[model samples]
Target: MIQLNTKRQFVYFIAVVLVIILGLASRKYSNFLPTFLAENAGDTLWAMMVYFGFRLLFVGKRILTAVSLSFLFSFGIEFSQLYQADWINQLRATILGALILGKGFLLVDLIRYTVGIVLAAFLDKLSLKYNN
Candidate 1:
């Protein structure tokens, strides 16, 4: 197994948790952010999904694993909004907030996640040229 250091594992852990929280908050704060961002929060969160997915995949796994987790994390957040909490949803009201707090979940977000994955994968390939 690939053993990540405490800090690395923590970073990954926090990333997942934070996104989940943001996803939940975004739904509650439906009135918090811009219409454009609010409408496409799925895409923005998908980018985070993309980033982490790529990061994990870079470490070596079947592409499906990263893709599955990416969709799971993103879609999971979209699903959580049905509960409607206060503090969590409050995050959707700000600029970055809307990015975190989604407006609402939709099947379309899955498409965005797919696009984000492709985009991230492309960026990952591009990064290889310079990151070394």
Candidate 2:
């Protein structure tokens, strides 16, 4: 189980990196993508990456653990945008902070996050079944 988990963690890490690349590309190359996808893919991939990150950290835990934690963490970050103090705003101004914390809130983002997390969890379950 430990060896299996180590392998799983490696896979999840790769997944996270891929998601990050895709997310950045979705922004950088938006002109090449479809309108809807260009508008939504970055946030969706971000949420998916978050789910994969949780899975990577909690390799032995159930899928629901990662799903639930991803939802909480993603939603928390979205809602945190409602608070705009100088310190946090300064952090949000930086490239890394803007990527992680976002600059504004959008109800659509909640929906995007929901879709991303569900899709990630579904894929994770499929991978588990295939491996088993």
Candidate 3:
């Protein structure tokens, strides 16, 4: 098991919060960024946030396990967009809903999510290696 002590878990939680803030900022101020980056940053950060969130919760899991779970959850959320109902749409219209469920589905999002989770896994491994 990949166990992190209380202090490390708290740190992971803080990182998740910071990433969420940055992801939101990226969306809000996207017009200021270059077009390519502006378009993709939010999606990528969304996956990264999921990875960190999983890391925070599954502190005893391996990095690859966390990454895999994050990818699956992100993909599931993306796929959930295909279902459209008034009630669900209304929920999707809300801020939290939009943030979690997303507005639509894109094949490229799967790739972006994979990239984000892979990067997160790499960073996780690096952190473990350096800290040990």
Candidate 4:
């Protein structure tokens, strides 16, 4: 694996921060995001895009591994919501909230995970070709 330089590290840091911010923003204020959030299918599909896009931008892991991690993380978070953390749950009910804090668990979320991971993998390859 190539060791990231200072610039790359900075980019990575920013990328990670953006990912977190977007994730949080999506959770806390879904209405502020895109038109897709108002629609269930669009929201799920966009979530997959964000998940995969983050993985693509991240440089610390192998493509497949990174994508898999993203998929697992998404799945875990959605599944964990079944426990119903009041504050988190309430937040998820919002437009952005729903994006991050999904409304409980749905089998379709697994499909979203798969789509996200695959997109991440594809984007990772694209990044390698163009950015590496």
Q: Each model's RMSD to truth, in Å?
A: 7.8, 2.7, 3.2, 5.9
* Models sorted by TM-score, best on top: 2, 3, 4, 1
Alpha-carbon error at 41 in model 1, in Å?
Answer: 10
TM-scores vs. true structure, each candidate: 0.48, 0.95, 0.92, 0.56
Q: How many backbone clashes does candidate 3 have?
A: 0
Better of 3 and 4 by TM-score: 3
Best by TM-score: 2
Candidate 2: misplaced stretches above 4 Å?
1-5
Q: What is candidate 4's lDDT per residue for 82-106, written digit by digit as tens?
A: 8886777778879767756667787
For model 3, what is the alpha-carbon lDDT of residue 45? 84
Model 3 residue pairs with clashes: none
- Compose the digit string of candidate 3's lDDT tens values, residues 22-129: 889998999999998898888988898899999999888888789889978999999999999889899999999999998888999998898888877788788888
Please rank every candidate by lDDT, starting with the best.
Answer: 2, 3, 4, 1
Model 3 TM-score, all chains together: 0.92
lDDT of 4 at 29: 73
What's model 3's lDDT at 5? 68
Worst 10 residues of 2 by lDDT: 1-10
Q: How does residue 131 of candidate 2 score in lDDT?
A: 96
Q: Candidate 3 local accuracy as lDDT? A: 0.87
Error of 1 at 95 (Å): 3.5
Question: How many residue pairs clash in all the candidates, one count each?
Answer: 6, 0, 0, 7
**C-alpha lDDT values of all predictions:** 0.60, 0.95, 0.87, 0.61
Per-residue CA lDDT of model 2 for 21-100, tens digit only, reads: 99999999999999999999999999999999999889999999999999999999999999999999999999999999
